[model samples]
Target: MVSFQQESDGDPASKPWYELGSAKHQGTEVTMARILQEQYPSHSLVLAHDVLYTTYTRFSILSMPGVEVELVSKPDLVVNNSFKALPRSAFVGTPGGDNVSAELVPSVEYGGFKLTWKDRHFLLYIVHFARGLSTNTQFFLLHDGPEEPSHQLLLAAGSYQNELHDEIWQFVDGFWQKSSGLWKDIQSANWDDIILESDFKAAVKKDVYGFFESRDMYKRFKIPWRRGIIMHGPPGNGKTISVKAIMKDCSVMGYTPLYVKTFKNFRGDEYAIQAIFDKARDTAPSVIVLEDLDSHITEQNRSYFLNQIDGIGGNNGILVLGTTNHFERLDPALSTRPSRFDRKFLFDDPDRPSRRLYVKYWQDQLAGSEDISFPEALAEEIADSTGKFSFAYLKEVFVSSLVSLLKEREEGHDVSFARCVREEIATLRKQLDKPQGPEVARNSQLAMVH
Candidate 1:
């Protein structure tokens, strides 16, 4: 047994053996080495990185998570650089203080680890394990030292076979909490529950994921792999929930959600933005969510924010999704420029059909709740009284109505409370929807001047 990268200059790129995986690759040589050392703790194990050619590469056609994105490998050897493993166990110091157990082993960076298994004549085991946490296992093997592809072979790792990596983050107290830090348990209301406009869903499908799948077109057109979306319109609409749904859907395609609570959370606003984008780009094909775009990306720090997104060699595979109540107030750079936020989907008041469906969605949810009666005609009655409310408003309407009905039920009042709840919701909507009076606008201007 010997160390593959035993007597080499620190320069890994100099080698002509093989190429490296994309930045998206998970496992590294250090990880493989750790596992190898643990498996044969007593035995002096030879450590080497395997170069996976076409033939030796493994293909996992069927698995729990079928056809995973891992450095695949099988039991095979390359022709040119023949590997000769000695049965005798020994250790000797090599150059750069990295002691080798045998003679020359393959030199690699972030690839699979090759080591002798049993007999002297036994061929090398080139394992390229898919390195991730999930029930859908890869038996992830390794390859190059720190800059190459790998395959899953040889070593039999135990419980690590089932690892689940939760990739949702939050910015809290000036630092970005990595995936494990924040609320990993995400419960998104069923897509059927949220009443979204027709065009909104269609455009999002074509704009975001379509853009993602069509990466070849981007390469041909020489465009960056980043998309920005502005989900605007009323406050209570399905903006926030819709964003969560996007995150859940995008996760299937490997787009982790990174939440920016507020610029105020950052110790320094400027560095915070840089850190956010840096992490986003580091783990590309990620979703950077700014729930309140106008509030966070204000006029004061908008310039710095713009520079972060518009920097040279702009973000690749980073989808910057922003939800703004005040769409017009958002910096023009975010909306005016096509590249910055290519799409703007409004969560306007739900139309008649949408409102009816929204109530039906609630009815389906409340079907089992025997506390109150979600009568058949109640859906239309509520929709008629609400007068074109947003998803959020409709939600509030049902919540308030349900609460009122519950109170009536406790008091042994008639179920007719639904009508009162409906009337009250209509009245509440009118007050919230009132156009800004002249005094309010004038005072806003005066406050700004000060």
Candidate 2:
């Protein structure tokens, strides 16, 4: 594959080597060069004084301009410092739904730039000078090659980059599973939508928004531009909703969302932690949403998981937002450590005022309904009656109430929406106070997480 054009200036043993890529290699020489021009560079640096240079003889007749070149190591760059290598082949279809014939050789990661002059379809790896002098800096070029290429390299680098940006994955068992489209569903609630303790809301707002704005501050402090947050409490309260709000808010600010369903999804792979951390690094400023964080970390992989957070490979701009119903189940090292889950937010069951606010929220949601509307006084009364109700139970009161009305309407009886709403609240209180069925226990469990 090496075509020695001539001795690399003054270094006789270090000859400038060129290769004419065929159907077998990374695109045709020209095709690879074209693709390389669009590659999101992995790292960029300047070549200063005392760097090597190999000038091509064909361009010797032209004015000896200062040689310049560009190098891109990754297929995509989602955000700043968010760059990574692509795989050699893909079983998944491209965004365009076409058969993607991309062969992104993970090993063949050298930056490239195109050569332009005299209609010559070729790739020339020239060098340039920048920054200050250093022995580590290097530059070189290959001159000799066939005038044309056999075929274009089918490296769908562009497509591959696009796919990862739009969708993320969990390597559960052998297949990739898509979970938590939280970003898209953020429209369901905003800061004004959820009813939480005011101080809690203020703190959450400040941390989430302030973190993104203070990235430079993080750098100045020589700290990683990353944050860890834990939302814990009984299920059916507001942990998941808060997490979604964070997801939506972060998305508006242009951070990518990463969802990890559980630790067991990795299925005991030695490299799972590394791979997970690597993906987050490649997509910096990403919100890693890990549901049930407490149960995911067992004694077996706890140490390994901890290493990834503060390890040498820890990435900047990563916001680790985890939600857990059981705080007692989590390790103190994970929940208490400032470097791991720095801040913990408790989503407790609704208090009296919160219960009242919950009723108001439902009223706001149903304001446009034509058939019936719950009055402001009635709403407050409903809130008073449901003092101990979680947001989940409050939601069910309305839903079950509507179902009862539907049944009455179907049976040709007059539907009294107000009566049904009030009755459903009383019925729910009794049912919750005295639970018996195994199915109800399972449903209660589901409601808590819901």
**Per-prediction TM-score to the true structure, in the order listed:** 0.57, 0.60
- For candidate 2, write residues 1-450 as lDDT tens digits: 322232233222112212322124432334433433343132122221121221111222112232232222123111223234434454457789976454342211123343333433223333221222311222222333431230111112112323433334443442333434433455586778777766767877787778878999998999878888887877788777777777766666777666766455334743556556776787677777788887667888888888887756766888877888888888888877888877777777676666777777788888997776578878877877775577888889989988998899889988777889889988888977834222211111111221
- Residue 363 in model 2: shift from native, Å? 1.8
Error of 2 at 169 (Å): 4.5
lDDT of each: 0.57, 0.57
Candidate 1 structure quality by residue, lDDT tens digits, 123-194: 122333334431112223322232122223222221122222564666654566544433333455446556
Clashes of 2: 4
lDDT of 1 at 229: 79
